[model samples]
Target: MKAAVKRVPVRNPANALTVLRLVLVPVFAVLTVMSEMTDSSLRIAACVVFGVASLTDFADGWIARTWGLVTAFGKVADPIADKALTGTALVLLSWFAVLPWWVTGLVLARELGVTLIRFWVLRHGVMAASRGGKIKTMLQIAAIAWYLWPFPAGLAGVGPWLMAAAVVVTAVTGLDYVFRALALRRSTRA
Candidate 1:
């Protein structure tokens, strides 16, 4: 007789961190809006919230993989939570005129396209995150934090440079994903 497989619970600690990240999104947004691009204390608060949320993004995946608590719910919810947090921050930054609208638009477009590609190739194969894609995510997080923080005027210039690098990496990684997804789908058909 075959032994039954033991299932990992959906309510595991890794998933809890993902949920926490999702919950922090709106709080971050609220604090950012209240800061109005000049209030240092509120901006600092918002920055702290953003940092904590970003850390959860890192921690959740680590905990899930390390502890063998990966679940179907985690597979779906984790990316959704990540995108929501990122998209919200980009939008807020653009709204405050701290970052260009085009920057947000391009990054978000690439992100949305990548997400669709994932769904498109889901039946064929899982498209793991590429090194370039991982770098793009880290660059984006760093750029966003740099912009969110109430840095001194001299240091303020660094955020734009970081964001420019992020945009280039984002576009490059997006094209790579598209090509890989097409290949994945084609190979599965053979």
Candidate 2:
């Protein structure tokens, strides 16, 4: 007689945090788009929402590591949530005239392109987030936060520069991932 193997369901607090962050994306977008609200109020609200949502990105990883709750779902959900939040913010900001459309488009293109590459690599094996990727994320978050706030009296000229730096880092890290993925494919073929 063959023994039956039990399949364990994947669920974790980390994934829950990721889902929470995903939910916040729309709320942040709505607040950002409503023109009736004062710029100061909108800026404060956007910052609060973005900060809380961004915190989940870190909190989920910490919870996963601390509780031994890492799972494939967490791996997938975390990055998706990150892209949704950041990408949505960038698009909404551009729509509201807080930023130029080209800036947001470049960021989105890098994010989506890298995401596709990640899915392709997943068929082979896990490719964990790199240090460069982490730096890019931090720079992106900082840029978004600065852009959400009112200019001049706040961070002044720092916002646009930070956003441009983030875009550069995003492109560089994305190319690095593409190179790695291609190398993996070549090695596997050989």
Candidate 3:
């Protein structure tokens, strides 16, 4: 007889970090909106809040794997929290004319598409996070942070370059995910 698998508790440090990220999303959005395209205290506060929340994304994943605290809730909520935080940042940056609307739209579309693909292939198998996905996330966070921070005028050019790289990675990884999803579905059928 096969032994039953041990279950990790949903209420753990790792999942707590994920939850914190989700909660911080709205707070970050409010701060960004309050900034109103100025290098005021509100912008700085928004930057700091966004930085903290972004760190939690890394922390929770590390803690989950290191401490074996992986749970179903974490699996579902982690990505949602990540997308929410990034999505809010992107939208706010675009709204304030900090970043272009097309950039925000493209990133949102790719993110949303990937989520849909995951659901499409859910019955066949779970799609693991790829290395490119991690890189895409890092680029997105760095780009968003660059725009959020009230940096000097001279350094203003850096954010767009970072964002451009992020866009490229995002599109590439998204296509890779779709191809992998299709392969998985086909394999399962055969």
**Which pairs, if any, clash in model 2?**
none
Model 1 whole-model lDDT (C-alpha atoms): 0.95
* Overall local distance difference test of candidate 3: 0.94
All candidates in order of TM-score, best leading: 1, 3, 2
| Candidate 1 vs 3: which has more lDDT | 1
User: On a 0 to 100 scale, what is the lDDT of residue 96 in model 3?
Assistant: 84
Tens-place lDDT digits, model 1, residues 88-111: 999999999999999999999999
lDDT of 3 by residue, 127-167 (tens): 99999999999999999888888888889789999999999
RMSD of each: 1.0, 2.9, 1.1
- Model 3, which residues run further than 4 Å from truth? none
Arranged by lDDT with the best first, the candidates are 1, 3, 2
Candidate 2 residue-wise lDDT, 1-190, digit = tens: 9898644346667888989999999888887777322477877797789999999999999998887787778888889899999998888788777789998998899888988997898777667789999999999999999888776755557988998899899989989999998988777777
Off by over 4 Å in 2: 1-11, 35-38
lDDT of each: 0.95, 0.85, 0.94
Top candidate, metric TM-score = 1
Backbone clash numbers for all candidates listed: 0, 0, 0
Q: In candidate 2, where is summed lDDT lowest over 10 consecutive residues?
A: 5-14
